[model samples]
Target: MSDTAQAAPPDAGAPPRTGHWKLIGPGIVAAATGVGAGDLVATLIAGSRFGYALLWAAVVGCIVKIALAEGSARYHLATGSTILDGWRSLGRWTSWYFGIYILIWGFVYGATAMSATALPLAALFPFLPLWAWAMIAGLVSAAFVALNRYEVFETVMKLLIGVMFVIVVAVAIMVLPNVGAALRGLIPTVPAGSAIYTLGLIGGVGGTITMAAYGYWVNAKGWRSPAWMGIMRLDNRVAYAVTGIFVVAMLIIGAELLYTAQIALTEGDRGLLDLREVLADRFGPTVATIFLVGFFATAMSSILGVWQGVSLLFADFVRNIRGGTESREELTTSPAFRFYLFWLTIPPMALLAFGRPFGLVVVYGALGAFFMPFLAITLIWLLNSSRVPKEWRNGWLSNTLLGGAALLFIVLSIAEIARLITG
Candidate 1:
């Protein structure tokens, strides 16, 4: 029991780890990326159209995301592999499917993201054309990604997240009405014309292809072991916890303010610009301007995160498929990574020149429809197998939650496809 008998010291080669607040990396990025322009528009459209009847859908969406994101993080911490590599171990076809999915997703998403970011900018600075503002957003996102390290990127995103919750939620609080009806939304019933929006909200809550990037952020932050699982859970919870509050605030604004006024919010990101008009009428131009600023922050944060995070995933995909697994140094320093990063930034700007990229836009929505189910199904496979150590794999409860997410997203996707096909 002597000090000398206190045993050999911990291994010098062991990895360093983060604790508590510093464990905040991936969760913040994932949350910021998830609550983009599409989410805002969807919630506002629901509010303007259906009042508070679909409020439960937004809350449910947030919960589903928490489960899905935690699964991604668990897979990373348990197996020490990116989801791309995890998919590859399942089969070569898995990699090919992801490659095609991401390629199409990114091309369309870049244009959509740029346009969303530009709406606020154009509103604020009318001198610049919308396309000009769009280019600036794309370039600004590219510059930030090119120059900043992961820590810097995360810090900036955290700040934008702070601004969004403060301004947007504060506005919602200022606008809440009919506490009785707002509470009734918790009953989980869908009104007429609300079924599609309800499913979209449920499936869209804080999700995107970037959810898979949770692991890279974990690795970037050095959160590398099973002991860190509790911390990972807390991080994911707090992230979507903030996201849930944000969506609820949007719903309140929609139901209390927009429904009462009988104002219709347009579909897509322009709906946020539309909200500016509604806010101006109710609360004055100052509040309207504040909302625009928040909208800009939301759009910009997602663009920057995708510019950096997804490009990393793309780079890894290339590395895995081409049999360069041993080249970690090259993977980080490779031309493939830079190429995808450029691809994410550049081509979509051309859409600004020839009007909006309608085809890209359509594909973005379709890709989005299937993404949550894809993530849920893949996480179920990855975490419930020998790929992850038995001790760290999903428990029955986790599997059940993920399975529910899969079903929910599948239903949502079917509805979306029907809308597209019929339209």
Candidate 2:
């Protein structure tokens, strides 16, 4: 967090339903955003390859994210400053880096997210090609955010999350996983030849630049005082708890369904499609369609989350640069916010048609890989600094978690970069 100027209170109309479980909005948004199409594929792959071998690692991943998110939302409410404002206090360079990062990151991710979300929809409605469905997905997601206030956006996200949860749990139960093996998988042993994946699973669960957007969401949700801290903590835990279960459910499906059959899935988003085929063959099209709907929810939630959350960062960035103040309402409706929403949805449509360029993919991969480490490092600095109130500063446990996250991500970043370069 930066020693940035404190923010003013949000416009005085909305009620603060502090301490209520119903007030758990932003954490849900962040969790849904974190567990996107890529994460789903990764979790599924983990299960197929090592039937619950890394379940303990998944548990660790959730704990680390809980710490990071707790620190982030804590900073927001404690300081009443957006994460952008905090970063700016470090130096103008932080703003410049984020500005460029969001531009490139959003461009590439918009296309990928749209395509991923559209896959099941396209399969369900093959009258249109994948690209056509991608376009529709992008447009529909954009319109959803543009139309909804934060409250409505959160409500819709919760609804989708319910659908996602029910389907994933249903699939896991259908697979009839061995209860004994799964319990032992929770014993924290890392099998040989699985170190890289173990680390990746542990470090990558429910994370991305959306981790940073957490603070913005907290701010947008009217949880702006230290008094709201306990509520934020509860909300953060519940969010990642949902994420933890979703990952585990997919793992169970992979372990029991695919592992027994000795199935190998393709890499990336396409793997989910392959799984859909397998599911349809084994369980019928109706069951497969239900799972696909869950897949759509996973991908589309990210689209909506980035649409609302990252654009909030853009609004804050512009506000800091111009040395002006804007209420939360103004930021949401600001041209900067809406423009990035358009940036994320529209220009990427071209990538859907022409296909992504090699260089663009490399850039996106490199930037995306580095963000966790960047966030981990900056968060440790911010939470320990004078910018946040002393009482709200990180305790030793938080420090240990953030430090471990930074170190873990540094290793993951190097591995990802090496893979991109060799390919």
Q: What is the TM-score of each predicted model, taking all chains together?
A: 0.92, 0.95
Q: Give candidate 2's error at residue 112 in angstroms.
A: 0.3
User: Can you tell me which runs of candidate 1 are displaced by over 4 Å?
Assistant: 1-19, 326-332, 356-365
Q: All candidates' lDDT scores?
A: 0.80, 0.85
RMSD of 2: 4.0
Q: Write the per-residue lDDT of candidate 1 for residues 148-173, one digit (tens) a residue.
A: 56667888999998898899899988
Question: Per-residue error at 93 for model 1, in Å?
Answer: 1.1
The residue-level lDDT of candidate 2 at 391 comes to 98
Q: Give the TM-score of candidate 1.
A: 0.92
User: How well is each residue in 114-163 modelled by candidate 2, as lDDT tens digits?
Assistant: 99988888888889999989999889988877776677788888888888
What TM-score quantifies how close candidate 2 is to the native fold?
Answer: 0.95
